[model samples]
Target: MNYRKATEKDLTAIVKMMADDVLGKKKEKFQSPLPIEYVKAFQNINEDKNQELIVLENEKLEVIGTLQISYIQYISYLGGMRAQIENVFIRADQRGLGIGKKVFKWAINRAKEKNAHLVQLTSNKERPRSIKFYENLGFKATHEGMKLHF
Candidate 1:
């Protein structure tokens, strides 16, 4: 398998992966359907210089996974830059084989390359496995994260 930055042609496959990740026949609270416009917004990541979308592909260049990072410079952290990992998804059958870790490491390295002081992510409470995966990768849950449906 190969991991590389995503391009326009990879959108359809990436969206499918994301949809599966979000609504995979699981009755999780986080399993809400995503609007088509939300998927279209991912195109902005490809166009933005400070943000990026990556796709994981096989030898045949078929997209099977995706990861994205958004950079934020903050004053509260002594003017440090932060990179937030978002929308990370792997093809369902491809889980548990270290591909997620591989992509995560790649994202970390990329953030470090960009001089980011922190790399952050949030896993839904329903995804205990994913939470453990992030913990194994050195992420800690230090603060309560809340969302309001409006």
Candidate 2:
């Protein structure tokens, strides 16, 4: 597997993978030529030095997974940098292939390369299996995660 920064050309596949799950199906508008909002958001993330939108490709160079890591510099943790992982998704057909673990290992190493103090990610409560996967990856639910949607 190869991991690299996502390009505009990979947007459709990325969105498609994101929408493959039940939670994503409720939120993502995965259509051909996707909503302009996705394009605009991609532009913003692409332009930001601290934001990394990544795509995982197989040996044949087919995109099969996607995730975004945002490096945030904060005054806490002794003025450290934190890597926040988000929007992780693997193509439906690609599940159970251990691809998720490989991608996460890559992401963690990347965080280390960037001098981040820690790497963190949040999965929806609706996905128990995902939470367990993270736990298996050595992530601890050290704190309760709360969200307020507008």
Candidate 3:
């Protein structure tokens, strides 16, 4: 898999893959042609120094996976920086091809580059497979995750 920082041109493929999955199907909106708000969001992320939107391409140059890594500083962590991994998605056909491992390894390496004190992510409790996958990657679920959705 070829990994690269995403460009605005990648939004369509990113949104498509994001919505192609079960959970995303309910929450993500892909443009029948592309949306203005999505474009704005892409630009915002691109401009943010603390965020990176990554895309993974196959040999054929198709976008097969994507994720966002955000580096933030928290006083609770001794004012050290932490990296949060989010929106990880691999094309349905690309699952179990060792691509996920590569993607996550890439993210972790990136966190290290940023000198982050911690790297963390949250998987929906409904996805047992993802939990097991993360566990296999050496991530421990030591704390409960909570969220307040609007």
Q: Write the per-residue lDDT of candidate 3 for residues 16-106, one digit (tens) a residue.
A: 9899989999988887778688889999999999999999999999999999999998888678999999999999888878989999999
All candidates' TM-scores? 0.85, 0.97, 0.94
Kindly give the number of clashing pairs for every candidate. 0, 0, 0
- Winner of 1 and 2 under lDDT: 2
Reference-based lDDT, each prediction: 0.81, 0.94, 0.92
Model 2 misses residue 128 by how many Å?
Answer: 0.6
Q: Each prediction's Cα RMSD?
A: 3.8, 0.8, 1.2
Off by over 4 Å in 1: 22-39
Among the numbered candidates, top lDDT falls to 2
Residues 1-150 of candidate 2 have per-residue lDDT tens digits of 888999999999999998888998899999987999999999999999999999999989999999999999999989999999999889999999898998899999999999999999998898999999999999999999888999
Off by over 4 Å in 3: none
Across 77-135, the per-residue lDDT of candidate 1 in tens digits comes to 78999999988989888887888999899899999999999899988898898899999
Ranking by TM-score: 2, 3, 1
Model 2 alpha-carbon drift over 4 Å, by segment: none
Note the residue pairs that clash in candidate 1.
Answer: none
